[model samples]
Target: MSKQLIIDFVSEITPQLIESKDGKYKFRGIFQRADVKNGNGRIYPKKVLEKAVAKYQKLIQEGRALGMIEHPPDGKTRLDEAAIKVTSLTMNDKGEVIGEAEVLVGTPKGEILKNLIDNGVKFGISSRGSGTLIKRADGTVVVGEDYEFLAFDVVYDPSTPGAFPETIKESREDKPMELTLETLKKDYPELVEAIKKEAKEELRQEFEERVIEAIEQKVSKIREEVKEELLSDPEIAGAKVAVEGILDILKPFISEGIAGEHLEELKEEIKNLKESLKKKEDEIKHLKEELERKEIALYIEQKLSESPDGDKIREAGILKEAKSKEQVDKLIQEFEESIRKTINEDKEPKGKGVNESRQKLSLSEIHRKLGLPVIGG
Candidate 1:
């Protein structure tokens, strides 16, 4: 059974704006380094990279070093349409493999990719290969010898992009050379069993990590919802300071190592405290409303005493019926108008004195006295 492994690295493509006549963009950077821990926390040893050097050279010679824009190279079948082609590859003294490639502008996909690069779209290179992986006891994984070097494709996914030469140096001390068949059977009988056990344990650990992450996310969402629901209540909203203080006080006891029964008891206590706080808050709100109503009544009484028709307004019970200062002001105005009308009626002549004075005044005299021009004699 052939297991698949993909190694990705950041390859800087230096575009040749003036050197090349062919409208193709040129890129040259380290494609692979030996004995390096890649983004997946796995190391590719020197021997493995050395073996791939010749394979890549052969692919370059046969004019078959082609790769896609974003997708990985199809397995050993090697029948996928390509967007870029590798022209040269050379390994350095540091065991870092550097390569130069040109973006194929002839094909439709290649033209699109070239346009994207020219327009400043960032792209990185990723290598796809097939191989089995060996996980060490220290959690470092090594690619086996069956690894085959495949095409390097242009990708847009952002990753930790840097030369991994330091990683290569560090992996050398921790990871020893691979054991031969004779050494595996004669010297290390437990090697095969350990590998099997480690693989199962690694899978279980990965599953557990995913499950824990999902549970934490759900818990966080539920906590936010509960907080929002608590804040929506007017009584609770006013007591947010007290609630936060209580939560802070109880937070240390709510964590791991506390027994479930004890935790439930603490929760019940907190619940009782919250209810008691809410009841006290309700009492405070009712008292505040009563105090405000009494204040308004007192204000109305004071305003009535300042008015000239205070006795009459108080007799009508308007001051007591008024709900607000504005209502009391309006009632006072109405009472003052009634008092003024009564005074004016008492000051007027009781019999025909007023009617006789009005009849004595002639129509022309009235018009002239009122500063009007009389017409038609």
Candidate 2:
């Protein structure tokens, strides 16, 4: 069916609410019923349907509870490492040695970080210990608690932590250099949203166009058959001659003795055919117009999505990238012609033999390559 006819049919089938403002393209709403078993089985806003499907998929994935992936830490020339230095090997209650281990955590390797922050290095320390009791039963000044082992290793690198470190460093206060969080968030949001939205809208539009096209084609077929029957009806033939007078039409027909039952049957058939044809014709008109409107809208949208500049994108000399009104119009014309050709070809009968089928296919291909819409003369 032609796009125009399909649009007319849909408009007739489902009462449409149409609104056209000066600055905006027309919007159409198709009325649908509620019963899940009825024809309105899957009526919903296109975006809403996609979101619902995505949400369901996410729920399923969550229910499965897929494990988190742990990729190997990136390899680096300067290692990020944390180490524990054994301070002192002490004897236990028996003649055993007990070694105390202490780990110090820091940013960058001792050498690497020091060089990066090229500023002068200033070190300050605070000691913690238990004062000793002595000297004439009074308190005595002490340098610090017995410094059994003051073991400190320079943090040349830092290793990522899984749990609390086994070793503990009882030491001074220190701070390391850090990267600010704001910088990471600022750069990626625009790119992410654009990709997601474009993909979603593209898929929704494709599905919708296919469904509308199918409905239009089916309705067109029904209308064509009815129209053919109506044009060939004998009652219509007899009606043309009846203008001469009732006696004139009956004189020739009475001699042949046409059956009354046959006339009744033909009348009934014509009535049914008329009703069916009218219904289908209306539907085809509605759907075809809707399809064309949607196609134009889609093309305009895609054109707007291209570069902000006015330069037309070159696409195999076809000018698929529409930067101006002229380009958009060209695309629409090309698409309509191609679609119409396909519909006409689909109406033809297929060959029976393998060789005949192959030849037919080859001819079809040649016609396509030549940019001609194949039709039976």
lDDT of 2 by residue, 28-84 (tens): 122111111111112122232223233334423443211111111221112244232
lDDT by residue (241-320, candidate 1, tens digit) is: 76577668667756655554576776676676679667866765675566557657766766776775565456556566
- In candidate 1, stretches whose alpha carbon ends up further than 4 angstroms from where it belongs are 12-14, 73-80, 158-377
Tell me each candidate's RMSD, in Å, in order: 33.9, 31.7
lDDT (Cα, 0-100) at 334 in candidate 2 = 63
State each model's CA lDDT, in order: 0.64, 0.34
The per-candidate count of clashes, in order, stands at: 0, 26
TM-score of each: 0.41, 0.20
lDDT of 1 at 350: 62
Q: Which TM-score value belongs to model 1? A: 0.41
Best by lDDT: 1
